[model samples]
Target: MKKAKAADGKPFQGVQKLSVSLDFYGEKIDVGTLAWSKDERRAYFEYHPDFAEKRLNVSPFKLPVSEGAKAAPNSPFAGLHGMLNDSLPDGWGRLLLDRYLQKLGYDFRLLTPLDRLAYVGQVGMGALRYVPDNSLSKTDDAAIDLDWFAAQAEAVQGEVDEADVDRLLEIQGGSAGVRPKIMIGLNRKTGKFVADDGTDLPEGFDAWLVKFKSNVDPSEIGKEEYAYSLMAKAAGVDMPATKLIETKKGSYFAVQRFDRTESGSAHVQTVSGLLEADHRAPSIDYDTLLKVTRLLTRDERHVRQMFVRMVFNVLAHNRDDHAKNHAFLMAKDGVWHPTPAYDLTLSEGPGGEHNLAVDGEGKNPTKKHILKVAENASIPRAEAEQVFEQVQRAVDRWAEYAKEAGLSERRLQEIDRLLNKRGPTTAPDVDISPSP
Candidate 1:
């Protein structure tokens, strides 16, 4: 069979200018235009006149609604605005795209950021859509085999020659994160899965993202993540629906796409994207997260929601809680709200410390540190304490959630011991370090 090209029938060349739009339901609203300047080696964006009149701040902090062409800071997002940068896939998705392009006799390094945005096209996580979309895919509504795709993912990671690069790229949907995953439209009633390529889905299907384990991951990572999702919800952290799809090959963790709704797609901006903060290293702290949540959503309830998530992460030992892991969703009216908590799992960040520190405490944040962060964020003491206790109680029942997830006793005990060891405590006064 002949392989598909990267951007429709067009050969993969670099993109100079791309049009941006917002896709709500099936309606497309022109947002802006992006132009790449070769001399400056950066991209400039100009908001559409109509969009500017609406004054819907797509990126309030970094790329707010403004007249004339605007250039983003160079350090964080490589000249592109943070909001647009969020649309490009990183980690696993980048790896797959690079490998696929290499097979087509193209040097991945030669492609500019605009070229990447072209590949992201309309299928990215948020409501943003790019045109002259160079994204590689064809319309084929065939049922998906998770087990087969899982094997292919493993093969690609292993750099085996027979891995189906085109198929993988078609299904990846330009998603972020390190785990090898695919975007699919699932029919719960019939237990059927189809490739979700940002197109209209068949009836009875909903968009979902499924994750397959990497070589270094534990055997039961899927079940453990499913358990964590349940635990997070129990602790009052807003979470999207999750499931553990078990196959003869292995169990894969799946979560329904919160960016997609029955009515249309919602705009999502990660803390990393909104602030241009890099997720690869420690940058912000819980206090910053809370403050941003309050500022963007203008809802104390959302601030409280962030606090609950912070408490859950600290107590559950999910240290990989980076900026990108948290996000805000925008309604059609341009109102922003905290997105449901995601990427909650057991992880040891850069140095066995939380990616986003708590009141300047990263290595060993305790109740004192949590409370200090709450105080800084202006959350009421009584309310913060209530939220902490609620998360604590849910985390205390690790064994129960683990059992429901069908985790091995040894694994369950290991996590239980870790949870107990990291349980909230009051530490002595120490010189607090500045947020990284």
Candidate 2:
């Protein structure tokens, strides 16, 4: 392990280089090697000549089959490609790692991005594994309590350096996204959950990720997301089986891991990674997504599914639908398709506009914009309209969903107002305001 310094002059420990591998069943293949540039801001990866022919395009959009080492084309993503960056945790997971590093008497500030991937080891989601593993071991599990974990996660998000929860970094050590989530193995029959150890889960149990509330989130965010899950399912959008873990204080959203299987794991590729589009930049739109889905899956059903997700994201007030939020899965046979949707919730996007524009309209996309996307994807107008009606029907029931979700009346009204004002509303003469 080595240390790197941030531009701000803070020293943190991180890995300088790592060997990347892909697992197919019990077989391991040397995919490539990654190294950090002198400044630690840029990264370069080269495929092993021997594995070139058999190599899969883990990130087909940008990092395709190649011989020479290729550096990231731009610095929008810290000079690292989105696919590799996905291997590193962010938000809550980053905070956990930093805290754990601090507890170990190492300056987390010295942590480099590659070092972050090293910590991901072989336990991260998707099929990518970083070797020369520098991952931290389980320090202690006794201190990982629901209330304490929630408190610490909230404190970390609030930038309260004094408040830190012990052992949290171990339980939720390898997750991504802004929310505080823990990777737990659940007993399929008993609905029991146990801490995951970054290995093959024991028999009778499957891996599930549980998400807790962030400091900026509403207390009922869990229930709200669960309700959205239900709504998504109603609209024919693919959604993983979801449940709510209730504590005396609140409820937490839990979703089964779509990438994990009893025998092994599957490869995952996000829209942003596959296209090399930076999720933070909001450069790509839904039209691009549809085209990519068509080109990759070659299946109209998959294209239509992607269309449904776009509708749900728009009508449900889930403006935080950035590129990373959309993903696909690859089977061992090398086939790709849309994965079940996760991260469904009400959120305000950058400048309160949808990260993905619809038919050149990001501010106030209506039925016309959606129809245009479907038409462009070659999905029949009739089928697309059915999707719109189904999604709108479910969204119209937002009040009922909110009531069942136990959301406060104030939040319920606030969200309901936004939903009603959506440009996708089919009602005649309803002109929605522009994105705020």
Best by TM-score: 1
* Model 1, CA-based lDDT: 0.86
lDDT digits (tens) for residues 248-339 of candidate 1? 87888999999998988888999999999998899998888988988898998898888999999999888889998899999878899998
TM-score of 1: 0.93
- Candidate that scores best on lDDT: 1
Q: Candidate 2: lDDT over CA atoms? A: 0.77
**TM-scores, all models, native as reference:** 0.93, 0.88
Candidate 2, 113-186: lDDT as tens digits: 67788888887777788988876665434223566667777777776776654456666746777788787887
Clashing pairs in model 1, backbone N/Cα/C closer than 3 A: none
Q: Which regions of candidate 2 are displaced past 4 Å?
A: 1-14, 53-55, 102-110, 139-144, 158-166, 408-414, 421-436
